[model samples]
Target: MAPAATSQKISEKDDLDATIKKLASLKPIGHSSYTGEIKSGYSGSWAEKLPETTKARYARHGVDISKGYPYVPEVDKIPKFVNEAYAIRNEVYPYVERGAKADPEKKALFGAAKEVINLTKHLGTEIVGLQLSDLNDQQKDELALLVAERVVVFFRDQDLSPQKQLELGHYWGQVEVHPQVPRISEEFNGVSVIWQDYYRAKYGLHLSFKKAIGGNAQWHTDLVHELQPAGITHLHNDAIPSVGGDTLWASGYAAYDKLSPAFQKFLDGKTAIYRSAHQYVDPENPLKGPKYVEREHPIVRTHPATGWKFLFVNRSMTVRIVGLEPEESKTILEYLFSVYEKNLDIQVRFNWRPTKEGLGTSAIWDNRASQHFAVWDHEGKENRHGTRVTSLAEIPFFDENSKSQREALGLSLD
Candidate 1:
């Protein structure tokens, strides 16, 4: 006999249809509808466009570029608790001057930089500290979009209990707590993510000898095995010292563009598989990682909103080159990984400092394109704790025209 009719299933289909119909009728949202499409040979001006969520997302959170500027964070003024970078806007004058001073190609690069992020903050910007009690609907929405654009942003001076940190994680997107470890707080059922040595010792977990290989530090987007791995990650540090232990970030745009034109063409459409490296996870400690948890991503991954490309492979978790011989794969990977590692100027180093109250801080970042390395520099008797919230975004794609257009607009690989 055929399976019995399920009312629940029919109801779900109805809901799906209604949502699809609404989306089908929707037009592109935001200035991106025009600016984004312009690079694709779309000719209609802004007036011809219909309202769209993409546009709204841009409108609500986009850096106001009409005034001509670049975003520079008011690092000195913003309080420790908020993401000071949120208040960043571009300063275009110097850029324009620099462009005018340079040759034509360098001038083009300066133009492209203008389109990078919101560049105006004359009225002053606010850095809202996030806590379970303080996260209102508007702030959550703003935080989500801000994360999607900047890839990573930071928050300092938070007094987050382990439980509260997990709660904050939930607001960002799906929570992927490490399986082996118990939750950090019994009340919140929160799990803590340990980095370096001190974090492992805090919970009576001994350091695995396998870490001697220094395997975990390889670069990768977080949790690629899940249908939706987190695109944004929140790492809260609880037991930080006065100095040392800086995290480094590399911009994918610069990474991809830094490649020679011939090499760029080679990877234009190629894909590679990324997985958890067995060496990084102690084989004896199954909880830390599986022998292999695999997913495939473009070697030249693009930023969804900006349409810029990044060299996606990192030293940490990327496993093998698809369809290549073992020797060929090793050679190619070695070349690619070198490019990823060698380009340091496109990267940023974040130094950790504790607040007067002794509570440390945390940062949220997009895992899809940006690569990060946590510096294990602190050496003391004290234990340190860091919690992260990882959010998800759509998978990667490439648009060459977007890259050229971005360059024309004054965006720089630097």
Candidate 2:
């Protein structure tokens, strides 16, 4: 059955159509890349031509100039998606399921599941049976509520296609289109290709990791530099290794609870600055090196759907506490980051190795309430790839009356 056509979906077709588009930047990494042509969510410009000196500068920064940019000359009519990264006219989608039902919806959704297992005490929940592609509006609504409560929900053996996944993302909210990175294809604009190896090679990053820890390996949420940020980000790993290639997620609410009452109060209203993964060159100061897209968000934010406060800082993007001194902010942030990094019970590690081809696992996470890290333990021997769609939510805000996840659920620490 086709999704109902509402006033919102005027020009949208049933599921959406796509033509094969071979991106120059993506052809090098064949199997893991998405080559479908689709509509773009935002308008961004890439340099068609640059001086040799400028090209050398970016190449030195680790870009593979030989493969060329992920330029679709037929689609974009330009040379590259590299050189300078900046997005304009990106539409922010308002979240729909705010204050949606909490109890009966969850009951109905879970009752339909063959076996529903909580992956961890504080957060992750894995549901077996029921294809994600067949979920009705009500089920989708309930699933949204469940994700807000669980932090991250998992589904195995789903036969969902990229088109179906993109449709699901639209139903959830406005899907985020990352202009800086190469996604699954042009046809599925909002769906991003989650390939660590693609990124590692793109920037000439080292591919060696023997369970190494700290630094960028620390906890992170997606697209913090966006004005509204990301809400529920869904990832379906179409390809996985036989061993290793796991992802670990930690509950932000629990991280906040790990703090004392006094400490929590201190962080309750604090705000922080976050940087984007893609850096842009300042045209005025091209030789000064690239600059990151930075945005500000509250340190402790309350989710509109859950009515709970969660620690909103991640070590990767989150740089400083707005109102503190350099050393003071650094000192406080280290301790707060430790609360998330050190906690075992608040975290859930998921291994994405699938038994069958179509039975690959999908993880739907509430980016507003949790942080996650993809383990590089696979070491590039096996191909691990996934397509991701992130829905934009409301600009993060804090409400003094909002309770923590544990406090709201009556789940005691003792």
Candidate 1 yields a Cα-based lDDT of 0.48
Residue-wise lDDT of candidate 2 within 188-227, one digit each (tens)?
6787766666555443444577544432244778888787
Query: Where's the lowest-lDDT run of ten residues in candidate 2?
Result: 14-23
Error of 1 at 157 (Å): 1.6
Q: Which candidate ranks first by TM-score, i.e. highest? A: 2
Runs in model 2 deviating more than 4 A are 1-92, 102-105, 210-218, 284-287, 355-358
Give TM per candidate: 0.58, 0.77
Pairs clashing within candidate 2? 34-184, 36-187, 37-186, 37-187, 38-186, 38-187
What's every prediction's RMSD, in angstroms? 19.7, 14.7
